[model samples]
Target: MTVTAAAHDGGIPAPAPGTAPQQVTMSGAINRALRDAMTADTDVVVFGEDVGTLGGVFRVTDGIARDFGPDRCFDTPLAEAGIVGFAVGMAMAGFRPVIEMQFDAFAFPAFEQIASHVAKMRNRTQGRVNLPIVIRIPFAGGIGGVEHHCDSSEAYYAHTPGLKVVTPATVEDAYTLLREAINDPDPVIFMEPKRLYWSKGSLPEDASPDAQIASSFGRAAVRREGIDVTLVAYGPSVDVAMQAASAAMGSGWSVEVVDLRTLVPFDDQTVVASVRKTGRCVVVHEAQGFAGVGAEIAARVQERAFHSLHAPVLRVAGLDIPYPPPKLEHLHLPGVERVLDAIARLQWDDQADALHLPESSPACDSPASDSKGGAA
Candidate 1:
């Protein structure tokens, strides 16, 4: 009755004409996955708020309902809890449900069903029934989204038992991971970093667009190779980590980057291996620091690669406070400057191993702005 979490290696089926294996936005790639999954499995249904006629707020689900008909792809009432509860029933009845959670903070209303039923049904039934549900949530900070629009809530699901959690930062992963989530036998929290929706990346010129999954969702991918330090990130903040790595190269530091693609079945081996090679590690995420995903990654790195460590495992994360308003978000979310600043803090020389404390306990690191609990 015990169900373990799982993941997949990215794969896509043969591509149709015009849908080339070229550069595509993350949203576009996801759209391709939805198209192919529905084409492959009639039991797979997609439903959520504003998902049908509207094509979803971000158009990730566009053209789906029109082509697939209301029975396969449709909209639901504005109740998150009901949407998930109904989907759970459908899953129990042999249908594979792929639901969309419009926003990060908006997914909470459905959390009751997600944690209580969607997550535990497989084990509770003693393997009689499994919930193959993919709850796609558009999350993370950036894009000037305010209030309930921007929140990194993946830790909640990742901490919950029985649920497989993952986030994709690249276009290829967007297509491949969503496809894998739909095909997984258990419930999966597919967190899509909304900020990266428009970010484009190249795919093989002749690759297929159908669907491909390699079953390596639990393994982290090395985005860059180096020896001085390891920079770990996933989802939206991965771009920030890459920027820091490039900047570090100019400063005579060879930095390595590891994208922790999946959260629940964390790829400890890949990240720990990177730390063992670099001797220093930094985990970055748009989520807050305390009890965050980064904390677990840092702990694992220290535990497995302790002997190879040259310094403490540092973390670059969003401010602990609630997400700021659109205008003031710049100071809240971790950016290139923040990442580089953290990278610069790692001691590279033996003589500078001793830590240097700030001259005074001043909260104002930049004279331009005061952290007066932001009025905007």
Candidate 2:
């Protein structure tokens, strides 16, 4: 499947409430988040391929082994399925196991374990069994890695009924969300954007007691508010959406950005609310467009906000082609320019063209109307 970007119009949505400062690199925040969670709960155990001795390929698990001891922080065999299956078994026995899949593509082998076993155990047992396993997989392309090393396969897990899929774009979220996922009494596929591992933002010293981790579990977070259109994205694409929104500001096109942190049990209320306010919605991801999470999100918006929509839901995604080589990485990945182009398409007015309207027509009559139109 190929990832695609869509466009829409109307007004911007309101930003989410702030719980912590955002100013740490994505990797640094995740490291700290995991450390905090482990420290708070002795039951929390972290293990996976090379995660213990190597501190993980991206260093997200650096120093964890030293701090937590080999029993709590260790490495396992290279088998993805074994890693996940063991995690499920451990969770069933009362330990919170956080397993790390080295890359996005590496997760496929464990699909059966996750989709059929980990995700359904609770339901099958009539809530008697809880699989509190957090599978962390470094995903997405952009660092010029070879195939299987940089694929965005979150859609697969998101499509599963009982799994919760989440990706953190900012450092604050990286720290907080991981803790939340670890604590939740279910299986969560934590997709970490490999390229954004070095991206920085500030994080809280401790998890927010009242922070809405569950709130974003299946819902979207509004990053920026504008009236012209809504740019929906997660993980790596979220940064692209923000950059596109900034560039659109000069063009007088206000773009609202929505970050769907969690894919499964997706927060349709947040997405629907934003789309209703903006009337146009565009979903973006690094995964192939075919049957991806973007399609699911677009379908939900169409169902809940059909009347409020000004244009059909669109998707901006990667090509269905296999992950290309390093040289072709740029073309394979979506960026700000592409997102802005999508917004322009959604805001296009053919009638204005016949009347000799300029190609760069104003997005809205006034800035106040566009800005204030967002949901609070």
lDDT of 2 at 144: 92
Give lDDT tens digits, candidate 1, residues 1-376.
1111110112223446777456778887887788767777779889998888888999988777767778888999989999999999999889999999899999999899999999999889998889999999999988899979999998899989999999998887887778888889999999999989999986434323343566757988999999989999999989999988888777777889999889979998899889999998999998888899989988999999999987788999988888899998888888887777676666554323222435363433323222211111
Q: What TM-score should be assigned to candidate 2? A: 0.84
The window of 10 residues in a row where model 1 has the poorest summed lDDT is 1-10
RMSD list, candidates in order = 7.8, 11.1
Predicted candidate 2 versus true structure: per-residue lDDT over 136-213, tens digit per residue: 999999899999988988877877888888898887778778988988988888989988998876665444323445
For candidate 1, report its TM-score.
0.88
Which model scores highest in lDDT?
A: 1
- The per-model lDDT (C-alpha) reads 0.82, 0.79
List candidate 2 stretches off by more than 4 Å: 1-23, 205-215, 350-376
Winning candidate number (TM-score):
1
